[model samples]
Target: MPIGLAPTVRSKFEHHKIDEAALDGAPMFDLPFNPGVQIRGYSAINQPNCQIIIEDFMPGTEFDWTFVHDEMQYCISGEMEVEVSLPPLYMETTKAHITPGTVFSYPVGARKHVKVIGDAPFRHLCFCPPSPDYPFPTLEQLKGS
Candidate 1:
């Protein structure tokens, strides 16, 4: 088969949707920059060039974050508004409401403020290019840079 003129072939790889049971017991990470927001997740793939993680964010909390590397997130459930500031001056911020099935990407050095809304947990699958021990930089660290 050809996809846009590129040769392709089907493989025997099996794919399955992440179920409710798989979301349980994710290890939580402490966010010193934003307290009271429950951030828990586990990494399914952490390799040299790629990293995949399933993260759950509890509702009714907002936090500021800056990625040290490039990342893309696919929302599986819940809702949130992410306001990403343009770098350099950061005089303006663009906001987007992310819902289930929405895929959002963040370039390295982009700063975003995430506000988890609604009553349920906001769950998303995150993909990154670099396998950093912790991908997000602290607010103070962002300032020091």
Candidate 2:
């Protein structure tokens, strides 16, 4: 299946091919706030109030992000070191080392710095649920942010 292809219809449900080869042709973009960092990904699921994305970050990529809505992420390959700020007052911070099979979540307004480490590209799946207002920012939209 080609990357960016609409979800396949499967008798009242949707299906998407998320293998790395399926996304090899997907376009890559630079994060506006992070120099020397590039990301390539495809949204496999786009529902009225939920979305699922498969993304790859080359080693050496680093950036800070703030969640627009609640999100969950599962690492599929490689590694990342993330520094997260505690909620409420957000006065304290913690670090997590993510590897394949790791699962983590971020609440709305959660902030973190992510660094792709190791020799290979870091791959992950990101899911946003319960609200459709928080589509991942596109390059154009991110440029002004």
Candidate 3:
């Protein structure tokens, strides 16, 4: 039998109302590295191919992230130190001093780390490829500490 590939829109229903007031009241999760850090996100609006996350990192806090899938990050505010690892063949790592308006992409399974160095909070928008492992565990998963 031939399978249909038509696109369909998913409704949030009453359980998830789309209101400015409700959205303003949405809960945010704090980053484990810094209690003052927080982030909020909603499911992709019109596409099933990506998800958006907004992250706020407090000054002096560092976050190490390992991707389960390809991802892109765009800095929105403040400054940070970004360290990215190249492929095994290269065996070289690159570091960038990024500030608001910087954008970068990481290959699937790439490992990256960031440190908030500016006095202001660092904020960024992250987009991840859609996958069964959409919400993967933190880097602590393998650190064993």
Best by lDDT: 2
**Candidate 2, position 66, lDDT:** 79
TM-score winner between candidates 2 and 3: 2
**Cα lDDT, model 3, residue 70:** 81
Ordered by TM-score, highest first, the candidates read: 2, 1, 3
| Per-structure clash totals for the candidates | 0, 0, 0
Relative to the true structure, how large is the alpha-carbon lDDT of every model?
0.74, 0.77, 0.61
Q: Predictions ranked by lDDT, top down?
A: 2, 1, 3
Give all TM-scores, in the order shown. 0.74, 0.77, 0.62
Assess the local accuracy of residue 99 in candidate 3 as a C-alpha lDDT between 0 and 100.
88
Error of 2 at 16 (Å): 2.1
Output candidate 3 Cα RMSD: 8.9
lDDT of 1 by residue, 1-145 (tens): 4567875433333333553554554445676677666686665555666667777888887899887888999999999999998666777778899999999998887899988999988999888876675554222232353
Cα lDDT of model 3 by residue, 8-35, tens digit: 6443422222233322344566755445
Q: Please, what are the lDDT tens digits per residue for candidate 2 over residues 69-140?
A: 899999999999999986788888889999999999998888899988988889998888853533344332
Model 1 spans with C-alpha error above 4 angstroms: 1-19, 135-145
